[model samples]
Structure formats: structure tokens, C-alpha cells
Target: MNPLTAIRMEALLSGRSDQLGPDVAERLSNHPLDSIDTEFPHYARSVDSPDGIERPTERHPVFFGCYDWHSSVHSHWALIRQLRLFDEHPARSDIVDRIDDRFTAENIAREVEHFEDNETFEKPYGWAWFLHLVSELCLWEDDRAAAWRSILKPLEETIVTLIKSEFLPQKRPFRVGTHQNSAFALHCILDYARTLSNERLESAVTDTATAFYAEDRNYPVEYEPLGWDFLSPSLTEADLMRRVYSRNEFTMWIEQFLPDVTTAPYDTILEPVHTNPNRDEGVALHLVGLNLSKAWCLAGLASTLKDHQYVEAFERSAKQHMECGLDRAFTDEYAGSHWLSSFVLYLLTRNEGGIAPE
Candidate 1:
């Protein structure tokens, strides 16, 4: 019947469905639905002047929950993804209603105004996720998706314009393992660009990635997973470059860049970092995300280099990291719960080849 429903049915009939059964889908979907509208415990990153403080909902009508702005945006993305993959989910009506309440044209315009006012507010991370949300809406064939896409067009245009004028022109790429990491943002932006058929933005991302990382060598893999880190800078760069280069070219580049991926010091990148589930510090929860992100990146590398010498290593590490990451993804801790589901959803989808490619 429905496209998503049809896909799920086909998978079931063919016995091709993986671990993302209806129960796990419901669990993952429920987290974002519960937090997307919750007001308290917000982490505002606004640059408000004295006497200008406002509630998160007051500042961001559409994306005011999920601890922070980017988390809220990607939480929305995760919800839409769940709805897309599981057509008969128990929370289907709730998902539709929440998205309907949030995707109003007026609300989106306010979001645009906020973005214009705070140009560098979310920078590469949140901006990339916002574009990704729009991209997801663009990909769905549902009527509601079309309406939401239309409402989001202005904000999408604003971000696309900003990237063309401001972000792409930057000479240096942030190689950190956190939100500021340029490769992660570029990878997401490139996906959005390709999804929307925005060749100019695609070219800009390709050129910028090349300029920033094309000649990279000896990535010092052992020095990664810095405290409070969620992404692997070297693997993220490799993931982005795989999108930029053809199979042959990327093979050559990765061989040089991570020459010792199968050896000591470098192989350490494969081990998932330990995350304390009962930790009090919010930032300590980043290790959970690090495991998930590493799984995602490693899986991508393994898929791309299926015939390469290090493909087995990549595959083994991806599986180990994914298992470790999933163990911590459903934590009761607010620090992990508010945002970790999105990473979980992403990793699961990537494993199933549901996400779009470059």
C-alpha cells in the first residue's frame, strides 16, 4: 500500500529484515517523541544579552526541546526516519501529529529569522542536520512530506546560501572529534546536496573537502577519541573522501592516509571506548556517541573498500563498535537519551543500506 509499508513488507517476505524489528523501532521512536517537546533541562547556546533571556520554546518554536538545538533537529530527523521505515508503527499517528504541529510555515519562518540573526549559531553541525532534515522530507513520497518540504524551503535556502558564501570559503577544516568537525559536516552537507540535486553545493563540498584533506597522510589514529569526543576525525575524513573520490582513487588515498590501519597504534582506533552509564557529567556521555559514530564510519569504509586489504579489519571493528555502542544507546541518563537515539537510528539504517549515498 504505502511506499514504506511496501518496503517493509518486501523485506519481511524476503526474510531480509535485520534487527530493527517493530519493537526496537517503537523504542527508538518513543525517545524523540517524549523529548522533542519537553521544555525543561534545555541547553541554550544563544548569545542573548542581559535581560534578553528567554525559554528555549520561546526562542525556537519548532526546535526547542531535546536538550540543545542540533539534538532537537536530528531527533526530528530520527522520528521521520522511523515513520518512513515502519509504516504501521504503534506511534504512527503521534509521529504524524507532532510533525504537523511543528512544520508550520510561520514556525519555520521564525526559525529562518533566528538563523539569520545568529548566523554562526549552530555552524556546521546543527546546520548540517537541519539540511539533512529537509533532505529527508524531500526524499519521502508522502503528501505531508511535500508540505513540510515546502515550508522548510526558506530555511534550506538560507543554509545553502550561507554555505556557498561563508562556510565553503574557509581555508581550514576543523579536524576535531566533536560537533565542530568539518569532515562530518561536509559529509552530511554533501548527502543533502546530492539528494536535492544541488550540483553547485555538491561541487563546493567536493572542492572544499579536496582542498582540506586530499593530500592528508599519516593520520595518527592512536591519538584519537580525545575526551568528550564523539567522532573519529581520521575516519570521518576518510568517510567524506570516499564520497568525493571514485573507488580507485579513494583506495589509493586511504591506503596512504591510514597505512597502518591493520597494525598496532592504528588498530587501536578500532576499539570502542568505554562509557560509564552512571556518570554524572554530561560530557562523559560523548563516548557513547563516539562508539556509534565510529561504527558508522568504520562500516562505511569497509563497504567502500570491500576488496581492499584492510576491509576485514574495518568490518570486524564496525561490528564490535556497533555492539558496544548499542549497549549504551538506550541509557536512562538524560545526557545520552536526549540525543543518542539519532545516532542509533543512523547506524542501524546505514547497516541496512537505507541511507542515500553520494
Candidate 2:
């Protein structure tokens, strides 16, 4: 499914499956796409980097500050992924109209101009990703294809340099940290490679994925000989009646430690065996509901196209989220982020085309 269609589905569903309908989709197609500013209100009052704004400047919508490459990577992946899904989905016309009005280069330039008046340079990654988004939007409209082709190369080259200097060699026992979050980088690399059709870039991405997988596999051994154990959470007695965690881990945990939380196996918490000695003692909960929901959606999309490898990847990805549980990563709400929601809808609804016969 196209990105806009996916986003439209997400908007329709919000928190309930019943809300999704053909009429709703039709109505949204006519609605103009709102920029990040409308969705995230804090942007208007958001501050820039310490050195970015002059004393007289007022805060703009901050996107929480564009200085961090990590955020940029996520933004890039989300935009590209959504766009790809949008272009390919059956509901293309609807999304095309909405995004055409909102995400155009001129619109992006206007936003940037507003920020520029404050003399705040978005982080390098932010600039790179936003440019890419604009270029893709141009491609969608077929209005500035030549310009995009000319500009994309330099932006990508800059990103490549950033990766080599700041992202290479990979980190050990990849936990959430500043540079350790190279998954977003991998996503960006893949998007750029797909865009530019560079085999060399593709190879780089594969190699990085392999290394990251190896780390996940050998997480325990990589840490101290004692192991890469994670900490677990302590539940309050008052909260016992509430759903403790999803069914996935609940079953696994209860099998070894008693009591199934529910009927369907829900997402669970995971820890590297070697280092996880402390996991049970820590209070970090998993963000399973949010994570698995997206994973399922991604897997569903891949499965619809009969891409076995991608399907596997989506399933594995979903499993990771289930293992992570809701509290640990996606506790903001059952809904999580809008991008994730839209991605899932795209995954779930994209022309089922056909599921290979089992």
C-alpha cells in the first residue's frame, strides 16, 4: 500500500479497528495533509540547540531538536517507508492528493525558512532526511525529478561520511545509547540504497544487519563473562488485577514461574541470558503491544507480497517488540507513535494481492 493510504488507515483506526471504513478513507483523501507541526503541538514552543538561536529569537516547533542523528535516521526511515508504501498501495490517488498539498518542497522550504530566521541549523541528519523527503515528494509529483536526482547524490554522500565517522565498527551488546542506535542508520542506508539503486550501498546494509544480528545472538557472551543480563520490574500489589504484561512472555514466564496472564500469548520481556542475571531485578517493562502491532503490520505487508524473507524479518521484528513488552519501549499509550500506527495500517491493508498457498 502507498504511504498516504497507510497513514489514512492509521488515522481511521486510531485505537479501534471498527473505526476503519471506506467512507472514512474517502473523506480523508479530500483532507489536506497536516505537517508535523499540527500533530506535535510542542513544536511551536520548542527550543533549538544552545548555539542555534539568537537571544531575540522565539522557540519554533523543535521536533525535540534536530541535532541528534538518531532522530534524523528515524525520521528518514519513516518518511521513505511511508512513501514507498503509499506509492504502491491500491489507494494511491487518495494519498497522492493529501500529501501533494502538505509535504511539497515549497512547504518544506517554508518551514525551514521559518527556522532559518532564528538562524538555527537543524542537525545534519535532520537536514539530510528532510531534503530526502522533499526530493521524494518531488518525484511523487513528477514536478522536480531532475532536481531531486541532482541533489540526492550529495546528500547521500554526506550521510555516508557521517555513518563512517560516527556509526561504523558497530557497538557491543546494543542497548539504547547515543551512537549504539544504528538501527535507524541501517534503515536510512537501506532507503538510500533502494532510492539510488547502489549495490555497494545495499551490501553495506546487509553487512551491518549481519553484525547487529550477531550481537543480539551473542549478547550474553559479549558482556562480562558473567553475562549480559537485563533487569526486570517489580509489580505492585494494587496492580495485580491489571494486565501485568502481554501473553507471550506471560506464558513463557508462567511456564517456568507459574500463572498465565491471558489466553492468547502476548508479547513478553527478553534479556540476554549471560547478562540478564539482573533483569528480573530491574523495573524495565516491555513495550510489546506497540511494537508487536507494527511488526504484525510489517509482516502482513511482506506476506501479502509473498516476500518470505521480509515476512520473516517482520515476524522476527514483531517478536522482538513482544519480548520487549509495553512498559519498556512503547508505554506512551496502546497507540504508540502515529508513524508506527500508519506503518502498521499500510502493512495490514496493502492489497493482500495473494497469500502463497500453504
Candidate 3:
């Protein structure tokens, strides 16, 4: 059996989400650098289930090139470092090493041998996500400077070449419904450029960021946590709301900056928003809001907006929304139940005299 597939198959059988989170964390601590060099081989072969039969498969003879879970793979490295739970179970490094062996340059180049240059929507598939994974890996582990250089140095040039050759002059907007992917790509470039101090990549990222933010106002676009691929463009506003993470982020971005107000005619309003219907949604919203609102407000108060009025306004906004944004997020079954309200319950339990903004 192919090595990466074999390992993944084993992991799947090992009680994934519930049981393996800690196991994975533990293994990472002991083997931080053990399997750093392994990579999964690209495959084109196929096998029928249980019965011997022919089946279609990826272009590569081993693992599908397009199936590269680069982000998830690299994320393993970061997770090991951050949680420190991997110290007890160091044997798990073998799994990580198996894949890194196949994730090398020669492997990737072979995988992209016939990649098309003119396809307008290159899917971006998993490349940017992997780059972010690499960044997280380097940041958390430290002393992985060589790994960072090995992965990012060549990758940046490849991405920049694509941007200059294919993306720069396209008068038409990108494939509709790909705002998040565009944002992720721009972020990868910007982040790596900032990390490595690469001026060329920085300039390219600036242009891409400007273009992406410009497109924000036209249609409903967001980075939903669970959806796969790009979602369909024609989803109604209500359905879109059901999938969007929070109205809070929308409000935050819209309040200060009108990035792409012209390109997105529908989003011209100052506070376009959405809410998830799951009971857990409200809790998640409050968690995100409190963390970010306090941080942003504190920074603003400390640096630029030191006035009493600005401070009061900021505090009032945070306090008001700390509990109000949940109305649409929570289900009717739990709507009136205060105990179920994450923000309200948190405020009640903490019971600290609140800041008066200034």
C-alpha cells in the first residue's frame, strides 16, 4: 500500500476527532524534527473496494497530487509545538515523517508537470492553505528557519510568476464566489513577504489585497469554517446568513473601511450581516467578539482614540453587542434561556466591574 495512504487509513481507524486529538498532540512533542523530511508520493493508481476491479484514479500512479493536504499536514507541526501534549506520546512522529518525505520539490514539480497556465480560476485548491500551515509551523516551533526557507523561498517565486503572468491585467473579476480563496492567497503572499522581507512579493501581495478588498461589497462572500470548495454564487441572502460565521466581523470591517464598496453593489450598506442558526453559533460569536472587541478597543483607546467620548462609544458598542448579536444566532428553543446565552452567562459569572471605555 502507498505509505501516506496507509498512515492516513490508520489514523482514520484510530478514532479520529474524539480520541486522536490528544494522541496527535503528544506525538508531535517528542518528534518535532524526526519526520520533517518525509513527503507523500503523487499517485495515479486506483483499486476497487474489496473486489478486484479496474477504477478511475488520479493522474499520478500513487497518491493524487491534487489531494495534497498541505495545510493540515503542516498544521500538525504547529499543533505539536503549541499544545505540548505530544510529549507523552512521541511515537506519532513516524506518521508525520512518512508524508514529508513525499512533499518535497521534486515530488511537487512532478505533480504539477502538466498544470495549465491559462485556466482563469486555478482553484488555488490547497496551496495557500499549506503556506499558512508552513507559517504557523515556523512561528510556533522556532529554529525551523531552514524549513521555512526551503518551502517558502521557491514557492513565493512560483506564486509571483503566476500573478504577473496570468492575474495582473485581467479586466474581468476572478471566478465568482472565490473571495475567500483570493483573500487567503493574498494573505499567504503578504505573510511570507513580511516574514522574509521580500520586496517583490510584498508589492504583489499589496495589489492582490487591494483588489480582493475592493470586491467585498458586491456579493455575499465569506470564509465559512465548514464549507468545501467554493460555494455556489446564487445562494439567497438567508441561506448565506445561515452559513456566514458572524455579523460581528462584517460590522467590524464595514464600520471603518469601505474596501470594495463599488464592486459589490449589494453590500453598499454600512453593516451587511449574517447569522448561523445552530445553538452553538451564539457562543462562538460571543467568544470571537469578546476577544477581538476588547483587544481592538484596548488598542484604540491606548494609542489613537484616548478621548473620553471615543472610549465611551467603544465601550458602549462592545457592551451592547456582547449580548445582542446572539438573537439571530441562537435557536428559538434556547432564545429566551439566559443560561444558554454564552455572552450573558460569561458576563454574569466573571462579575468584574466593567471598564467605562475611557
Better of 1 and 2 by TM-score: 1
Q: What are the TM-scores, per candidate, against the unseen true structure? A: 0.92, 0.43, 0.42
lDDT per residue as tens, model 2, 79-109:
3334443444334554445334443444344
Task: Candidate 1: list runs displaced more than 4 Å.
Answer: 1-19, 46-49, 279-281, 351-358
Model 1: lDDT equals 0.81
Q: After best superposition, candidate 2 residue 192: deviation in angstroms?
A: 3.6
The Cα RMSD in angstroms, rounded to one decimal, for candidate 2 relative to the true structure is: 12.8
Q: What is the lDDT for 180 in model 3?
A: 35
lDDT of 1 by residue, 253-293 (tens): 99889858777867899899976655535778898899888
- Whole-model Cα lDDT per candidate? 0.81, 0.34, 0.35
Ordered from best to worst lDDT, the candidate numbers read 1, 3, 2
Superposition TM-score, candidate 1 onto the true structure: 0.92
Worst 10 residues of 3 by lDDT: 349-358
State the weakest 10-residue window (summed lDDT) of model 1: 1-10
lDDT of 3 by residue, 83-185 (tens): 2223344444553454455446665454344234323333352444344444444443434435643644454346456666665444443433333334434
RMSD of each: 4.5, 12.8, 14.3
